[model samples]
Target: MKRIILSGGGTGGHIYPAVTIARELENVEPVEILFVGTPNGMESRIIPEEGYRFASIPASGLKRKITFENVKILCRTAGSLWKARKILREFKPDVVIGTGGYVCGPILMAAALSHIPTMIQEQNVIPGVTNKILSHVVDRVALGYKEAKARFPVQDKCVYTGNPTRPAIREAKRDESREKLGIRPDDFMVLIAGGSRGARNINNAMLGVHRHFRDTPGLCLYHVTGTRDYGNVLKELGEVDERGYYGSSSRIVDYQHDMPSAMAAADLVIYRAGAVGLAEVAVRGLPSILIPYPYAAEDHQTYNARVFVAAGAAKMIEDKYLTAQELIQDIEELHNHKDVLAGMAEAAEKLGKASAGADIAHMALELAGKKGER
Candidate 1:
């Protein structure tokens, strides 16, 4: 029997990748998996709901600048390291794997100090401070973006496995999804989603996009404005149906629960450049206009978008410069030029790593085997 410990949290991006890897590990073979995260972090709720054993440690993010709080955080981190060590000693796992999050820092460090086989998966082109520090101690580093390797201190240990996405993302079928979404075969479906909480800039820009395409035939714009912006976005585009449909061409929603189906039905995507979202876009071979969130840690979202831009899979529009005209122009260019759209789609397909979850799981098992041999 193989025992594996997975640690990551704070957000869905960190938690879901660990869940995907756990599912892949189970698919490959029978294994006992334990998820470790901060008690109040999002993972504490999400991990157990996914039906994995869950554990918690005291963990918090470190402030970037030198401050009095940094001293207190350092003290708390030391206590978390002791707790993590205790958990590892009792669980006696063969290998410990971390996805990026502040919570994973002490756990991975504890595992490394115990001489346990350890690995960390970095999901962005710009490595997070926690993952950057852990890279020195972990045995192997799985990279969600190959471009991220140069940012890590120990580049030799890094392997480009790409980011793991939910299985539903890969399983959603375009024709079926399009039919379900009431989109016709001849229609060009454009999906605009700014992460879950929603981007106010994207929503504000789309007020013009909806008006421009209102009566256009053969073009469908599906916009998710997020909860905060939903009412305002709907009110601004007046004379809409109860279903938030405007004219013959646009439908607006507060949130999209079925993103896989949305992506499956989309001809083009206008999205924020979160690593997990981009990973889904890549595997689905969807070309995108990326607007990276300016406030992300270390400006990592911009770096993540650059990889896609460089790969010819996406066009980047920085948030500061994002306007209705810019979005409309990009949409027009892509809409009019089928060749450019097809080429971008092809480039996206080339960069897709549908096997990333399985690859990371296999790597974990190999490390487990190495530990046994030693």
Candidate 2:
């Protein structure tokens, strides 16, 4: 049996990878797993639902700007370290693995200081502040994008493991998924999304796109606008769609809980260039139109987007410069050029590593002194 502590939280970007890695580890060995996160982070809900033991600490993030909030965070981090150390001592895990989040900082630090094997994964083109600091002490660093290696301080410790994603995505059936979603066989399905909360710009631009292609017989668009903009988007679409501008070829949903299925059902994906999202899309060999969110921390999404563009798996449209006309044209070009579309899909398949989870899990198991069990 391998005893492991998977520490990560705050955002789904961090939580999902941690969860995926945990599932992989479970499949690899007889493992006792626990997730350490903050009390208020998303992981508190996500982890337990995944059937893993979860613990919380008093951890908080440090702001880039120096302010009273930073002081508060400093005090909280100091307190959390002691609590995290105590938890690790009690749990007596053979190894600790962190997926870049503030909560992972304190827990992994404690594990490192206690002479336990410690590792952390960075799920972005640019490493997070917490992971940057943790990298110095942790035994190994796993990365979703190879471009991230140049950004890390210790290159020797980093491994390009790619990002771990849901197993359902790895095994999804496109035809079955399309049938489940009621998409016609001849329709070219396009999936549009902007993270979980939704991007207002995408929603607005998509309105124009709908107007342009509403009457096109087989070009289907399934858009997931975040809850914040869903009502307005639906109302706006109701008017244009009533005018037969969309010809009932478009579907709008506030949220799609089964993202793996949604990805499986799509012929193309238009999305923000988050490391996790790209990993999922790549795993499915889905060609993408990536619009890097300009305001992302350190402008990392731009770097992530460029990687795919260079690989010929994706095309980039800068958000500030992105127009509805451009979005529609891109869609038109891709649909009209099936050969190019297939080539991009092939590139995506080549870049996508479906074995990321298993590889990382095997490394963790070895660190936990279960070298040959798997």
Candidate number achieving the greatest lDDT relative to the actual structure:
1
Locate the minimum summed-lDDT window of 10 residues in model 2.
239-248
lDDT, candidate 2, 1-374, per-residue tens: 67899999888889999989998998987899989988988999989998899999978777778899999888888999999989988999999999977898889998888888988999888899889988899888988888888988888999999889889998878888888887887899999999789999888999888878875788899888888998788778676443223467777778888887899999999999988899988999999999999998899889888889999999999998888899999999999999999999999988888999988999887778842231
RMSD of each: 1.2, 2.6
For model 2, what is the error of residue 24's alpha carbon versus the real structure, in angstroms, after optimal superposition?
A: 0.5
> Over the stretch 156-210, how does candidate 1's per-residue lDDT look in tens digits?
9999999998899999999999988888888889999987778999999999999
How does model 1 fare in lDDT? 0.93
Alpha-carbon runs more than 4 Å astray in model 1: none
